[model samples]
Structures are given as C-alpha cells and as structure tokens.
Target: MKAARRALPLLAVLLAIGAGACANETHTVPAMPRPDEPVEGFDAHSPGEARIGATPADVMRMLAEDGKPSPTEHALTPEERRKLAAAFGALTPLHRRVLRERLHSISFLDGMPNNALTSPADANEPHRLFHITFRAGILRENLSEFLTQKERQCFDTAGSSRSVSIEAGTMDAIVYVLLHEATHVVDGGLRLTPGSAFTKSAWSDRTLIAPAFRDPLLARVKFRREGEVLPIDRAEAVYAALQRTPFVSLYASSNWSDDLAEAVAWYHLTERLGQPYRIVIRDQGNQVFAYEPMKSPVVRNRFDALSKFYEEPG
Candidate 1:
C-alpha cells in the first residue's frame, strides 16, 4: 500500500546509551533523536545493479521487522521470468524510465498476504531505490478475476444476492498490477500526487479530500474506512456516490496516492490498451447496475492531468 516505515529499535538503544552516559555526571541528558526520522545512510540493497529474482534477504528482514509473515521466496522459472518481462515491457515509456532510475529490484514470493508490497530500498531516500514484491499466485490469474477478488474485499456478501465483479478482459493479472505499482513508483519518485498537481482540486491531503468531494455513504466502505465493510446490497449506493467524484474506483477514494495511481492505471488500461474496465453488479444472477468508470465525465475529466504519464520523457 505504502512504503513501510523503518523500525524504532535503534532509537531505543540510542536513548539507553545516552542515559548510561549521564549516570554519574550532573549534565543535561542528550536530546532524544526523533523516532520518525530514518537512520542516516541506511541502504536496503548492497552496491549492484538491480535485477529480478526471489525475494532478497534485505526485503525479508524489513518484512520481519515490520511484524509481517516472512513468506518463502518463489523460485522463478525461465518461463515465469519471460512472462514478467513481457508485463514490464508493456508499461508506458515514462513508467519504464522511472523504474529504470528508481527501482532496486522486483521479486516474487510464495504465499504473500497481498498482491504486492513496494518499499523504499534506501530508508533515507524515500524517492529512489524502491523494490516491489508480488505474490507468485498472481502470475496464474487473469485480470478480471484478480480485480474482482480485490474489489470483493470491501463488501460482506454472505447472505445477499447482490455482488460486484470486474470485466477487465483476459489480460495477464501481472499487467494491471505492474501498471498500478509502477504508478506508485512514479508518484514516489516525482512527488506527483500528494499536495501537488493531482490533488489541488479533489484531495486536500493524503487521507482527506475537500468537503465537496466527500460522500458519507462512500466513507463507510473498506478502504475509505480501514477494516470496515458494507453489506453487498450497499454496493450500488457506494458506486453511485463514486460516480459523482473524480476518483476512478472506490479504492481511489481511500487516499490521494491511490487516487493518482488508480486514475493513471485505469486510464492506460482502458484508453491506451483498449481493455474494458467495467464494474458489473448482479442481483440473484440478474444484471442490475453497471459502471464503466472511464465513461463518467467527472472521472474522464480528471485524466487531463494524467496525460503526463504518456508524454515522452525529456
């Protein structure tokens, strides 16, 4: 979702050492270092050119430090690497350039809890040296199924006839995920979204938007309010509220970074790639409501800013 924050154990040790230094002397204690700041000169990768491979040890360490499950690295076969290369090759020229400059590596891990995780390769340099880890499972999935599963996470459908599904066609799931994650890389490297050009009108900050853009109904959905879910019946109302905003998806309404990433990714998916990006809602196997996000004027107008992603980089 976002770059993982570096841990605080080292700060605790520094405080302990500072206290020990003042044990027998009558002197002021040294100022405690800020916990939020990154440790100076901390680099996640050793000196080398970036490559694709199994999850590296440094990445595993960071996940462990962050209290996440340390899933085993999936050994990539020649065919798998070829598939990944094709996905990378499908990216826009700007995305390719950004990744070449800032990406430390890309990895696939077995049993990853989420589809992917992107982290800074150098803690002190948040914009550069980034690495992305994807669940190996995604390589076996199609775009429609992958996106449907992701959208499904936001609702509780246990006893309802209503359900939502995406029709993104049969493109490799890797293409969509790479496009989304690469947008994040571009956002971090260029500072394109937060409090800048993309956010000026809609988003007021990272997690909050302007009053006009807010919807009380949409606010109760999963990403909008973390760990919360609405009944499957509420799917229609949620999407109706979404159609009124500049956001491309319900997840985009969650925060500013995703707002930019989803907008750019969907723009590329639907416009440039000519893939169908439709959201279908069904009630007892009967079609009820359908939304093609890019067709919404409000959402389409927002793409004027995202044109930067397609421009030839100077």
Candidate 2:
C-alpha cells in the first residue's frame, strides 16, 4: 500500500494521481486442494487467468532467457522489461530464486489499472504466472496519474518522497507493487506459514488467516471501503485509525492478505533497503503528526512479527 505526500515536485505529481495503492485480490478458484497440491481449473488461455499474452518471438525470447513464462500475446517494451528486471534484481537472493522458479513469466498489459497480479498455471505443476499493468504507460507521467491529487498527498504523509525513484521518482512505487504481489506468490505458491495466512483464492477473505495474525487485529482492522472508492476526505480519520492498529499502511487496513502483503513489501523496502518510512503531517508551518513505523512501538511490534517470518529458520 503506497501513497504520496505534501506537494513536493515529484511527490506532488504523485499526489495528483495517487489512488491509494490499488490492488484487487480476486482470482478464479475451482476447489479446495492441499496447500501444496495443484489448483484445479486454472486456464492459461482464459480471459480471467494471468497468462503472459506476449508474441511468440517475445515468449521465445523470455523462455530462452529464463524458462519461466508460459504463453500469451502481450508485448513488453525494453524499458518495461528493464524496470521488471531491476525490480527482480532488488529482491533478496532467496526471493529472487523462488520467484524465478515458481513464477512462469512476468506479463505487462495495456489499459490495466495500477496492479500486479498472479495466477496458478495449468497442469499438475504448482507454479504460477505474474502480470503487471498500469492505468497508463510505465513512465512517471503515466504511472503518476494512477491516483488523484488528494490520494497521493495522504499517502505521502507517511512515505518519504526522496526514497521513491531517483531518476524517474517512480521506482519505489513500482518496486512496492512488484514485491506486494510477489509476496502473494510466495504465500500461495510456496506454502510459507505465518505470512501465508490466506489459504483460499479469494484475496479479501480473512476467515482462514493463520491464528497468529487473525487473533490479534483481523477483527478490529476495518478497511473503510473494502471494494469501492475511498473518499479523500476520509484520509485523516482513516490514517489516524491506522495509528492504533498493527497494520502499517491504509491499504494493509483493507484485508488480511493485503495487510501481510503491504507489510512484507514495506519491511523489505524500508528496513532492508535502508530507505525512509517516516510519516508526518504539518499544520501552519509546524509539525502536528509524525510516525516512523520502524521506530514506533505500536508498528514495530507488527514489524517484528513480519521479520520473524523471514529470519527464523525454515
């Protein structure tokens, strides 16, 4: 879950187009299977599935470079591929390998909103495919428009504008979306626990989350509008509500899966990358509200839980 802050040039641009870290966890699920078992009814060619959709030559190139992506007709420009590659390079070796092996191929699409999605592949294999599509082009001008002015400002209140992309000021934004969706692939594809709370395909269902996470905040954390547009006026009240909960971002406040996804992604981005995760609000040239999750007692507790998932021996 990412947003923009006060109108600083790049940040302000982000503010104008911010849409509160858009993600829709909906997927086609056939039936319940063992966590490690192959999901039934996963159609690669079906409109609903997450196939590559790249040209045959492009698919061959991707397959030759790395035998991952299954097949589709979608085309990715060199720059888009570079961004994806850079994002892939940013992951820890462990995560990178897991994604490379478990993920079939990464697909970029046209006219899709600000979301990176994943779906299981066909056959008996447990692997999955990844898809990324922005509301506009991948460039800053296009990507920045994903959200509105007010939405990005609300997000910037907690995020450091300096930490986004130095060149385009959009890399952090792109990386966060990649990692957030990748976390889901790890959860459902690899069968990891703790963070692997949601067992079903429906992304919003918190009923089956692991006891450790469910017992604590699942019942209390309320996503203002679970599936609809959230008002800009509600930003203040909603962020204030986040202060008391273990969730790190407003998007995390959406659902259990969303909660873990945003937390895990930000944990790596801020804690590991040594980037800023500071949140502050000013009134009449004076600071009124401030919080840095890594430094805050309330947020750090949840951070500790997320840390153990990666640190403890598996």
Maximum-lDDT candidate: 1
Tens digits of per-residue lDDT for model 1, 205-259: 6667778889888777666534366888888988999888988887777777777
Model 2 score (lDDT): 0.43
Poorly placed runs, candidate 2 (over 4 Å) = 1-24, 27-74, 123-172, 193-233, 280-288, 307-314
The top-ranked prediction according to TM-score is 1
| RMSD in Å for all candidates | 10.5, 11.8
Give lDDT tens digits, candidate 2, residues 1-314: 21111122211001011233443333222222243443354343332113334422322232221233333334656765566566666665545545554554455544333334444433234344333333224433322232232134333333322211111123335566666766665555444423333223223344343333333332332232333433333444545655665666655654555666667877787677765664544444455555555565655665545543355235
Task: Enumerate residue pairs that collide in model 1.
Answer: none
TM-score to native of every candidate shown: 0.81, 0.58
Model 1 TM-score is 0.81
- Lowest summed lDDT across 10 adjacent residues in model 2 is found at 9-18
